[model samples]
Target: MSRDEVLVSTDWAEQNLNTDGVVFAEVDEDTTAYDNGHIPGAVKLDWRNELQDHVRRDFVDRTGFSELLSAKGIGNDDTVILYGGNNNWFAAYAYWYFKLYGHSDVRLLDGGRKKWELDGRELTKEEPSRSATKYVAQEPDRSIRAFRDEVVDAIDNQNLVDVRSPDEFSGKLVAPAHLPQESAQRGGHIPSAINVPWSKAANEDGTFKSDDELRKIYGEAGLDDSKDTIAYCRIGERSSHTWFVLRELLGHSNVKNYDGSWTEYGSLVGVPIENPSEQQEA
Candidate 1:
């Protein structure tokens, strides 16, 4: 299979649409996008509702996850191909969540829905109905995620990346003006974390850059395979996109997604925070 184990091209996805055991999913920040039009037969995974805990700032519990999968007609052994509208941001987060729960065969749709739509691939409003399945969730993998303490420990020792935009990194904005829900009490990145916006790794069309380009992009920014790397964004969605780029496309080992991200990091009192604008003024 020429397809990278973790990523599939648009051609691959289109060719496999009718393939047995392959389930296509669209994970989006905007719920209506899927209803508007999506890849034919692709089911919807709402980023806020399906993958998150209803009452907590964490992911769904194992039972909740299993139920969500079952409700989505996903068998534990089935192949899942995920894509999204917003440059694959939510799709990559979904990918990270599935990996944490040990879904063995999930793959990201390369370039995601942007590429699919830009290529003028057919979109359908019709929904697919698959038989409901009974899925058993695995124990969550802690190695792929980081909590506040782990991030505090990582300040000096690990490759901590802040994948939010420059404004967010500089404390000029807590979250984008449009997303008041993502705003944090604090607006700066973790102290000593380097700012590398998530979109830098992708082209204008949302496809990832070539491998050599990717190597130069991160390597120049002091990221490499040698150290364990942690990436974070406002609430970890954008950072998960960078996580996908580094861990899957670039083949870096020991990459973890700090899913709690800035939301958790910023709210903590007495934690070291960095504001580039402050440093510049000083």
Candidate 2:
């Protein structure tokens, strides 16, 4: 999908919140903040909270995922728009999940809450009500997803892009402080995977940078759109944003998101981690 086709602006949403067949989902993982205020007519869902059952290190619990989407008034053909407090962080993951379940016509709100609040847009304190609907999940496109088994196969077959901070990629750290360290389960990135942190795709204000800038950044990291790229970060959140850029924005046809990401891969039966100095000292 083209960048223009996949991202809607806050201005557009402000004008069309109640448009027919268009639904706004505010995937603001922070419930307290969402309760205080959110886009008027927007529905809220926490990526993890709505999940029914996730095996340690997996993205979504399949049967449970279908049920959650069905209960949220989301259907296969609806035009779904997503946003959140963070610069499309959880929003991107939500988008990926919906797409995985065969939902077409999904888009992310560009700039997200930062841009909305910056524009002095009005927000609502009322919580959105859930509406039940029927949804059909199609066969998952395995190419756009990754599992522990595929990851091992990818070690020599494709380019694995570790979209985490340098420290985390180097195995110096496991988890972000807000989450438990034990949640990481293991400590490193896929072997030979290039390190290109997800923050490289956005600016301090949470809005994405210009296309020229993004192109240069990805190019410098040896990430070319022509190659098959698989991206992963802790729990698959950050990498989803990168996946958006590479797949939706840059139009890389072979881009995939390793939803299992570091948490799953690290804790797998046994995967080796390479320290930063170990690479340098080599």
Candidate 3:
């Protein structure tokens, strides 16, 4: 899909709220907003419970993913419009997952629910249902995802980016206030990983930056299509947003989201570590 097709504006979404072949889905970190109110005819997708594997610390497998989407009444040919809080953090993560599973026409709700509410758009507690259709799942695409072993190979190549906040990247902040001890045994970043906070890719209104500005941001960070790029945050949600920017917005060919991220890398034994804060005191 074209870059424009990757994001749908509020105006477009409002007009197409009940349009045929379009399904509006709200992806949230939790179920509060959805339980209270949501876009009419929209389904709620919980990022943690539904999308993740029950046993492993990874995404749900192909069979599980297909069943979940099938239950949501989403189909292969339907266009999915996703939105959520935290500046569309989990929404972007869901978008990445949809692409990973080979969903043909997934699009992010530009500005997300926050912007939707700010605009005073109508939200309903009413839930709508469509006939459940079988959603065919595709083989998990590894090109858009980076594993621990892949990250190890990319470390020395300057292809890994820590998209956490400066404090988190520097090991000054272990984790966010809402969730603690979920990161890892350590606070520092992976050795050789560059720090570029994920929020830099968005505007004050939560819309993405312009293509030129986005290219400049990544370009100034020494990233191009020359080698594979791996992006990570604490648990990979924010990095998925960055993944969207690099791949969907910038049109880079070799970008991957390191879903294992800091929680996986920071706690792992025998891995190299770097603490710029520690070095600064020396």
Candidate 4:
């Protein structure tokens, strides 16, 4: 897919703020950021409470997803424009989730809230109101998602991109430094996986780098475009950004985001692990 197909600029978003069949939703790591201030006419999607299953360690089922969009007044035919803080980290995750449920026209706001704010655009505390719709959702798309077994099988065969910080990949930290350093039974990236932190794909303004720059970044890191690829991080959110880069922007045909990621993989039994921190200690 082309960049324009999957991403919309801040200018485009500003112009389409009131356009019919276009919905703007902000999804952030700090779910409360929306309450503080958000783009006019945009809605808030709490990633923790709205996007995830309360009873299980998985995403909300298809029915729940349908209910969510219905409650948010997001119809199946609407074009979803997702944006958020931390360089659209959770927004990209939501984009992947939306695609998983077969939403055809979802796109990320290029540069997200960060760039918008940096550009001195207007933000509002007011929320929009709209009547609900019967938002039907399709079954989850397995092609763009990876499970634990598939991850293990791809260890030596596919392009396993560990999109975590150098510290996390080397087992020095289990999570991002800003967040609490707690997650997984152990730390370290999957064996044979290349370390390509998701932040590398973004510019200082949170906008993604040009297509040529992105290609060179991954190409230098040994990513083979012909092979299928899987990207994972602590909890899969950051990796989703990279997944968007590789699949949607770069147009790599076969790439999946392993949402189970390190939180699931590091805690599993009988799975091979390579802890560089431990090796250094030895």
Candidate 5:
């Protein structure tokens, strides 16, 4: 399909699961979910296995990313549909990873596995077939990602976003994972970040909120729809989902996800981390 022809409904995906040029991917951090069951014709891939390099705090190692995509029969031209057993949480993160790596013809399965299964869709236990394919890495859209240095500089004069829980943003609780190991050498947010949890873009069930509601929520957080915005979370996964919602769903013109997120930002040793709670209104 084309970039303009992105998202495919679960029904459309169900009908086209086995079609050529259509790649069905199951992205979950947990391998057991895929082992238990997955969409028919869907291939299982751990977020770390196919999406990120475990050793690298930021993203997939370039060479490893290429090899992983090729091993899964995913090529540059493939119209890939990604979903996860857990409400497409990891799938949305995978979608952003593919886009960052320059695969433009990719989309998330709306409502993901939970919705699909709730609608009585078909699932499979055995893995799907695969054929090797090649992908020529295209120049990445730097606007959708940020590195340590860039984030440090942006802290001085840019709209940084903390896509974590309000408590984390307030420094009330430390990160859940990456204990004692900071990804960005810092312990707080980029000096001026707005704390709007990535999950805020979606409802309790993982369905995204309406455009109007998104606008209101973001607006309330001091995010100008007309300005450039940078979002970050534990390790870029949650932030990527927010990036998608902001850039694609809300029609934001300039949005970037700091893929290094707090993990990379917090581990950088001297980068200042701001706790928004300290400045809360009386």
Candidate 6:
């Protein structure tokens, strides 16, 4: 997929704010940010409550996803434009979810909320009212999703991109600094995985870097574009951003986001782990 196919500029998004057949959704790590003020007519998708399954550790099932979209007044054919804070982290995650359920025309608002705010774009507290539609979602596309078993097997066979902070990658912290340092039984990265912080793919304005720069960024890190790649982070949102960079922007054919990520991988008893911090301590 080309950059234009998956990303729309903030200016373009502003022009399409009221365009029919187009839907804007804000998915932020700080879910409450939407309530404060957001792009006019954009809907709020609470990542924790709406996107994730309530009873299980997995994502919302197809039926649940359909219901959520239906309630959000989104149609199957709507051109979904997703944006959010933190350089589109949760937004890309929601974008990934849209693809997983076969939404054909989903794109990210380049630069997301950060750039919009930086440009002094208009934000509103009033929510738009639209009649809900009965949206149908397709079966989960496992092609872009990596399970624990697949991630384990890919350790040495495929490219494992640990899109986490260096501290987390080195086992100095189990999670990001802002969050509690606990989630997994152990701390470290998957053996043979290379650390590539997801933020590297985006500029200060929150827009993704150019394709050539992206290729060089990963290539210099020893990533083989020809090999199947799996990206992972603590709970998978950050890695989803990297997954978008690799799969959608870079056009890598076989790239998957292991949603379980370190939370699952680090807890597995038999999996091989490389804790540089531990090695240093020893």
Q: Pick the candidate with the highest lDDT.
A: 4
lDDT against true structure, model 6: 0.94
Candidate 2 has what TM-score?
A: 0.89
TM-score of each: 0.95, 0.89, 0.96, 0.98, 0.86, 0.98
lDDT by residue for model 5 (1-282), tens: 222355677778878977999899889988888888888888777887656656755566667778888888788888988888545768878887777778878888877777787788777798887888886666666767777787778774777788887767776555744356433434556788888887778766566677789879888989865557788887777887788888878777677877767766666776676765655632
Error of 4 at 69 (Å): 0.2
What is residue 13's positional error in candidate 6, in angstroms?
0.9
Q: What's the lDDT for candidate 3? A: 0.88
Expressed as tens digits, the lDDT of each residue in 24-91 for candidate 3 is: 99999788989899989999999989999879888899999999999999999999999998899999
Assess each prediction's global lDDT (C-alpha) against the native.
0.88, 0.79, 0.88, 0.95, 0.75, 0.94
Candidate 2 per-residue lDDT over residues 172-198, each given as its tens digit: 678764565665665667887989888
Backbone clash numbers for all candidates listed: 0, 0, 0, 0, 16, 0
CA lDDT, candidate 1, residue 249: 78
The parts of candidate 2 lying over 4 Å away from their true place are 52-63, 129-131, 177-186, 277-282
Off by over 4 Å in 6: none
Worst 10 residues of 3 by lDDT: 174-183
> Candidate 1, after superposition: displacement of residue 110 in Å?
1.1
Q: After superposition, how far is residue 225 of candidate 6 from its true place, in Å?
A: 1.4
- 191, model 5: CA deviation in Å? 2.0
Better of 2 and 4 by TM-score: 4
The sequence of per-residue lDDT tens digits that candidate 1 reaches over residues 173-225 is: 88865676456677788877888899898899988888788888888887756
Q: Least lDDT summed over 10 consecutive residues: which range in candidate 1?
A: 176-185
Candidate scoring better on lDDT of 2 and 6: 6
**Per-model RMSD to reference:** 1.8, 2.5, 1.5, 0.8, 3.4, 0.8
TM-score for candidate 4, please give it.
Answer: 0.98
Model 1 bad stretches (over 4 Å): 1-3, 177-182, 279-282
